[model samples]
Target chain A: MTTAEITVLNKSGIHARPAALIVQIAGKFSSDIHFARDEDRINAKSILGVIALGASHNTTLTIEADGPDEKEAVAALVEIFQSKFSS
Target chain B: MKVYSLLSLGEKHKENFSFKVLVHGENRNLSHATMNRPGLALTGNFQIFSNNRIQLFGKGETAFLYQEQHNPGLLVNCKKLMQEPVPCWIFTHGLFPPKAIIDLADEMKCPVFSSNLSTSLFAIRSNQILTDEFAPRGVVHGVLVDIFGVGILLTGKSGIGKSETALELIQRGHRLVADDAIEIKSIKGGNILLGAGIRKEVAHFMEIRGLGIINIPHLFGTGAVRESKVIQLIVYLEEWTDTTTFDRLGIERHYKQLLDVTVPFRKIPVRIGRNIAIIVEVAAMNARLDNMGYNATRDLDDTMKRYMEKNK
Candidate 1:
């Protein structure tokens, strides 16, 4: 498994749109990816799981990925989080 | 997918539903849940005639047939309907079968039945009876209770306190559906599970070890008991043991199969000082939340990983 810590730079944090974007990106890879904050963790590929995090701006989150393309999955997720989930 | 022959249906529900057979069609089968009124079909418009459904001839249909008696095409249309393997024809409101239709039915060997009930009432009652008759059914050893608008079935061994927990739950304002033997029926092709007591006389009664056969509705009033409910969750009580490991995270979803239908299942260990009733209540509420797409375990997992990342 590959893991990376990334902060949410988006002003709205992980709201509906950004969560949907994360799910979209995470679904592209063959790896199982999850986002963890505090004592909670959820599937990165699930929009509901991402929205349930309620991670506000600047809150650091851990992205974990495991499977055939774990490294690529973690890298792509970290990029999405650092880029404020894109415009 | 079993079909009930018209003769068997006539024998089974004759007394209760007041079904009077006008003509006997021995080989005809009644399989569908829906009944149709072939008003347009009688007018020689066979475009939307549902041949598989049981046809009903009410006041309006009978009047139309009587008004159209002079039309030669009317008998032809009636014959066409009877020849298409239709289950049976019923005349409601104590209406007698018309001469032409009865003659065609007799010749075609199609079943014809009449009832004293009004058109709307007979339609509604027949629909319910047919749906129940055709539902996939099986008996489950459990206590079904309605908690927080969710139907939960409590299952366990013979002496594992299933009824006791149900009694406690009822005391907490939940409604008991069935005790000991639950009759589970899968309606709509196994998409739903409807539960009821095995017998109407013993429906709301429960048997606790020390307390023999307590009447729930009598003790707690009618609000504490329900005739039937759609089972949404199944909680199995097990004796706590060191050897058997349980699911601590609640991420793995479990399901139990009843009458070819699958329902959400949970295993709660019965141990000292553990309030099983409260756990069951919480489980019921949690099931509602899960259905609404809010899973606490998954949310907590996300939060924990973030904390770990910052500390590392």
Candidate 2:
């Protein structure tokens, strides 16, 4: 299992489109990924779960992945958050 | 699920609903959930004709057919329509099927039925019946109630106060859908789950342990009962045990699977001095809020985290 903390930097924060992108990226990996904000944790691969987090700009989130490709999954998610989900 | 025959429809709704069989196509199947008014098809427009639907010929369509009886083209179009394997044809407002149409229906082995109901009334009643018949169904032992416009299925072991809670909810202005046995149907390709009583005679009747069977609609008026409701939540009641742990914070969500569809589920411990009906009401309202994108637990967590961060 691997975990990384990242701050949401996109001006619009994690809305529907960005959450959909996150779910898509999470689906590509074999790992079980989850996004945690404070006490609420949700399956990162589910678009509804990610959107329910309601993470806004500057909101810190802990991305946790568990599987053989956990490191790659966390790195990819952190990079997306750092890049403001442009790609 | 297999298609129902026209004879089955006549027999099933024999008591209240009436249908006069104009042509004997008893072997034809009615499979689809929707019925169609073949307005354009009667006028020789076969491009958008849906053959599988039960075609309804209302006053307008029947009038058109009557006016165009002598037109040879009309006979050809009617023949062409019956050529397709339609479920059946129904005439509303006591209108008789024209001889030409009836002849084509008999030749093509398509059944035709007539009803005394107005076009609008027949359409509404048939739609409701067909929707129920075609829905994917499963039976569950529970009490279904409508609280705050949300359907909550109270499921637990027998004698766990399921009906008692439902009765209280009914008394509190909520509506009772079903008790003891609930027939849940998944409509619109498993997108929605609707709950109804297993038997028509027992609908809206709850059997309390000491009070026996009580008709909720009769006791509390018609507003206390609902014919059917789309199930939105499942509340499983369990006796509070010393070792059993309950969900104190509503952060994580649970689901109960029924007929291949997953509905939101919650577990509430049944304990003395605890008002289960009020808790179920709040649960239903909270579920509505969750659907509207406002989660109280998550909001409280964020507030507490922000407060701690500022203090640190």
* Pairs of colliding residues, candidate 2: none
lDDT score for residue B20 of model 2: 78
The residue-by-residue lDDT of candidate 2 on A1-87, one tens digit each, is 899999999988888789878977998898878877764456686554565567889999999999999999999999888889988
Candidate 1 residues B209-247, lDDT tens each? 665557898899999999999999999999999999999
**Whole-model lDDT values for every prediction:** 0.83, 0.82
- Give the per-residue lDDT digits (tens) of candidate 2, residues B1-312: 547776877679854447777888647777787888788887788887798888888888888888764676887877777764687778888898678778778888887788999888887877777776777776567789999999999988655788889888898999998776567889866788988876555666666666645778889999888888999999999999999999998898999889888999999999999999999999999999999999988999999999999999
Over 4 Å off, model 1:
A1-87, B1-87, B90-99, B102-129, B310-312
User: Docking category for candidate 2?
Assistant: incorrect
Q: Relative to the unseen true structure, what is the C-alpha lDDT of residue B163 in candidate 2, on a scale of 0 to 100?
A: 82
lDDT of 1 at B148: 93
Worst 10-residue stretch by lDDT in candidate 1 chain A?
A39-48
If you score just chain A, what TM-score does every candidate get? 0.94, 0.97
CA shift of B165, model 2, Å = 1.6
